[model samples]
Target: MPPLRPELQAAHDEMDETGQDYAFAVCPTWQGDAWEVNTKEVNIYSALSGTFKSHAEATAAGTAWLLGV
Candidate 1:
């Protein structure tokens, strides 16, 4: 996978219930007004839709969805 931005730290490096390894990170949108939660499972990468006002919010939401918490 490509490297994350210098200002951004890596997040979510745990396996889900099905034992699939995954990771997620909060990236700035193209417009730079909000954050998008980007996830990686196996070799596929995707971004979840949502408007997060801050990086922490995006990270929390992504973690919940990824872990099914």
Candidate 2:
């Protein structure tokens, strides 16, 4: 896999601080051309939430959730 986007990396790092293992990846949507950042536990099969258009959005949302912001 390619290196994760910086925002994603930051989110991962933030998650790590909480002892939650999560993954951030770009996934193709059922809409064909649409793609999103898929956030989930590292070894989980389902996504924790809906996808975001870019890594930064995904990271921001995930980070906020984690921080209860």
Candidate 3:
């Protein structure tokens, strides 16, 4: 696997520290398909891509971040 970027590492750290699921999704207010940060995971198909992910790890993790793994 490629080395994770610092920002990606930081995001994972923040997710772990806060016990919240972090995911990438389309910016609701933005006018494009590009993804942005999001907390809700109920219906996040907008995540065109994923940087990191976990599943069934914890309930407080904002969204399960199931990277199909």
Candidate 4:
């Protein structure tokens, strides 16, 4: 598996406090111009949709989704 990006690592750290089993990924768009956040355990939380302009935005969205904020 590829290493987690800094933004993702920070988001994961925040999510860890929620005490829930959540799995997600932040990936680059096909055009390599944006970021996308996808969750494996959508049943546990609302899926974060739409592409983000940067890794930070994607990470924030994922963190909010996992933390239910």
Best-fitting candidate, measured by lDDT? 1
Where does candidate 1 clash, by residue pair? Answer: none
Ranking by TM-score: 1, 4, 2, 3
Kindly indicate the candidate among 2 and 3 with the higher TM-score: 2
Colliding residue pairs in candidate 3: 20-62, 21-61, 21-62
Query: In candidate 1, where is summed lDDT lowest over 10 consecutive residues?
Result: 9-18
lDDT of 2 by residue, 1-69 (tens): 898656456545654555546544444455545445545565442444676676567566656654551
Model 2: CA > 4 A from native: 1-46
Q: What lDDT is obtained when candidate 3 is compared to the true structure? A: 0.36
Tens-digit lDDT track for model 3 on 1-69? 896455445544544555434353223223333233434343322233332232222222323344531
Model 1 ranges with Cα > 4 A deviation: 1-20
| Model 4 CA deviation exceeding 4 Å by range | 1-20, 42-47
lDDT (Cα atoms) of all candidates against the true structure:
0.68, 0.53, 0.36, 0.66
Deviation in Å, model 1, residue 37 alpha carbon: 0.4
TM-score of each: 0.64, 0.36, 0.32, 0.57
Cα lDDT for residue 13, candidate 2: 61
Best by TM-score: 1
- Residue-pair clashes per prediction, in order, are 0, 0, 3, 0
